[model samples]
Target chain A: MAAFYSFMAVLALVFIAAIGAGSAGMYTLFGVAIPYVALLVFLAGFIYRIVYWAKSPVPFSIATTGGQQKSLPWIKNSPWDNPYTVTGTVIRMILEVVTFRSLFRNTKIDLRVDNVKVVYGSAKFLWLFALIFHMAFFTILIRHMRLFLDPVPACIQKIEFLDSILQVGIPTLYQTDLLILVGLTFLLLRRIVDVKVNYISLAQDYFPLFLLLGIAISGIYMRYFIKADVISIKELTMGLLSFKPALPEKALETTFFVHLFLVSCLLAYFPFSKLMHLAGVFLSPTRNLPNNTRRQHYTNPWNDPAIKPHSYAAYEDDFREKMIEAGLPVEKEA
Target chain B: MYHAKYIIPALLVFLAVVTFPFWAKGKAVYRVELKLPANQTECIEDTETMRTSHMQILDHWRDKVVREGERVYTNAKGVKYSMSLTNTCMSCHSDKEKFCDKCHNSVGVAPYCWNCHLTTPKGGK
Candidate 1:
């Protein structure tokens, strides 16, 4: 069902691109206007969501830990997993951001070979795929800077050169392209073949994967098969950047339109969907906060204060005679 | 109160953000205009093809000539010309500064082709 919905979504995008570009001949509108709209939605929605999250108060140091906590001086602390200090928390965040430490710590229980006892073991494929996928995507984005930046920056040029150093064919092949394809394939297959994953996976989950796969496939097709004119694409890109969007004639094909439209869809969907995890990961209290509940006190500012005793002046007023009778220390005589 | 405090401000912000596209559309009054090459009755390739794939063609020509020592280019129309930028292209379009630089500068591209090719007389800007 999930696959069906995702397939329909992809088909819808392709149909829209075909109809818009083929029948109506509005390549400029689809290429330029849609991207602009998507980017706007992405930025606005991201900021709005981040602001909303920031406005929500977190009164507890409820950082998740998979290991031991910091307690007595002699006790060992899992610094990265159960960060007690700000530095430890930052390190944990770095590990989480860079290596996905928590996912690396993922474990699953399965039946032993003897079939009598269950065994707990590591499940690392998803983590590995996710890490590689993110890294490859980031690299690909940076490498595309060559299109947007004329007399492209030295770093970007070097990255581009390094990416296609193998140069098996006419225009060199990038390793990231292969890696992303594999990563996305692994992710999709896991969702389809694994019963547990397939059972839990909604169409929402499959939609992004299928959509991303479509984007990647279309992009790969453009780079490898048709070989869209780079200069004209650059001109169009520069036009977009410089705020004067005129379509370069015959440079953008249906494949390019499909790639661009799908990317636009992803960008538009990013903020409103579960894909906000790209930003949400940072704001997560479980990941970002320090786990120092033993040393620090936390109070919920939203909760009301309890009833209290009378003021010192009032106490003095009420107990003045009693104090006079007892000759105890008193603030005032009433 | 809700209308004034919450809804109005949110609406104003959204309105402000969405206005950028209109502003961008409005402000681009002076776009890049390329001057046509002089003295050439027709180009090697069609106008559309040249507009799009000139960079790829030039790059291919550069590599083929420099690496393989091939110096002839046969266009789709079956006309042959020597693969020399200074001799062939500049022979017809003598004014690079006026023709090419207009489009390049408009798009913020600064190609290093002028570094090797003599665009101006020696020691002149």
Candidate 2:
């Protein structure tokens, strides 16, 4: 996996350089062809992983239960924490997925006042940051949908307008971009600054953060410095979408190539990376499986019929002679 | 207590796996191409009131030129100009056409650019 990752990283760097040099032919392959190929690979790899996991034998109910387990009404039970019924499980899953309840409940230990301090507090900042990062990234992606569509969607326009409502300057600064950048930086720093995290960190951990930072830096450069030829870029994009390869004269700019190149690298690297989690998260049985197995039975698909029965009657019949010899009591004794 | 030793290594492995994607890099390039007709197009009408078309404006701008006092800037309208040029070629054959298109369409391209923008910004429109 590391070898795979390293190889991908090298290729991404080459593409980055290619963009910086302002070559449109290479840019087209990177921007259009690679993205398409990556999408297909991503889908195939994603489906394979899901199917493989789904086919794995679970043998027993190993669902991680934290809420209240179902019990008799007369007895007190914890429903939210150890849900035993289907309804409880559904509610628990929702809270886990949407609210990140586990992360919200997280606690950190701090030794203060010469080790005498003992305080229990909620460590929900991680959850908040994660939510902010994901939400902002999602909003930014949706905002970019205008580029792909001929007549931009109303919702996208509204979102774009709302994102730049602060009206920082000409062309309007998108709040989500700033948020994502800040969030990414903070998250990366968190990994580096904390002693335990740093101790556990590998080159892989630093790579994504670095790659994202590279993307952000390039984007900022394009917006403020390079001033990419968006019109020509759009023409090429639309042409590609229409399956017509009409190369426009003087349509592309150096900065546009860089942006296109970075995006392509991201696409190609997606399937083989942790980024695949976007699809993997949905296929996770732990999250997707309903918790009503106690009420509903799931037959074991691996059962065979070679084993002999050892029922009480059979045992008695087989051991009757031995019992008579040893003078032990038996129901079928003469 | 027995699970503690293995847990540290397990956590380390998980973290490592999670970070692998960032390390992978791929090759990509940004290529730009300029497509022009085999024969050059120019706009050169001899009237004082001659106007150039939007297409001619692009031809002028493509070469990257600037003149005294008057300046043209990129704007949303400029984007429209670029798009329109993709379909029509005659919108930029002369001074009157270029000026009229710039004024009426709300975007402007250069007139002096026919010297280089096209092999023939002289005839056609």
Query: Which regions of candidate 2 are displaced past 4 Å?
Result: A1-15, A19-25, A74-91, A110-121, A292-302, A305-334, B1-125
In model 1, what lDDT does residue A53 have?
70
DockQ of each: 0.07, 0.03
True contacts kept of 1: 0.01
Would you give me the overall lDDT of model 2?
0.55
True contacts kept of each: 0.01, 0.00
Instruction: For residues B6-124, write the lDDT of model 1, one tens digit per residue.
Output: 33465457555534334433223334455566557787888766755665677788889999999999999999988876777766666787777766544334455677777544333
Please give the C-alpha DockQ score of model 2: 0.03
Q: Indicate the residue-level lDDT of A155 in model 1.
A: 80
lDDT over C-alpha atoms for residue A285 of model 2? 50
Q: How well is each residue in A134-186 modelled by candidate 1, as lDDT tens digits? A: 89888888777666655456787677767777765544678999999999999
Report the number of the highest-DockQ candidate: 1
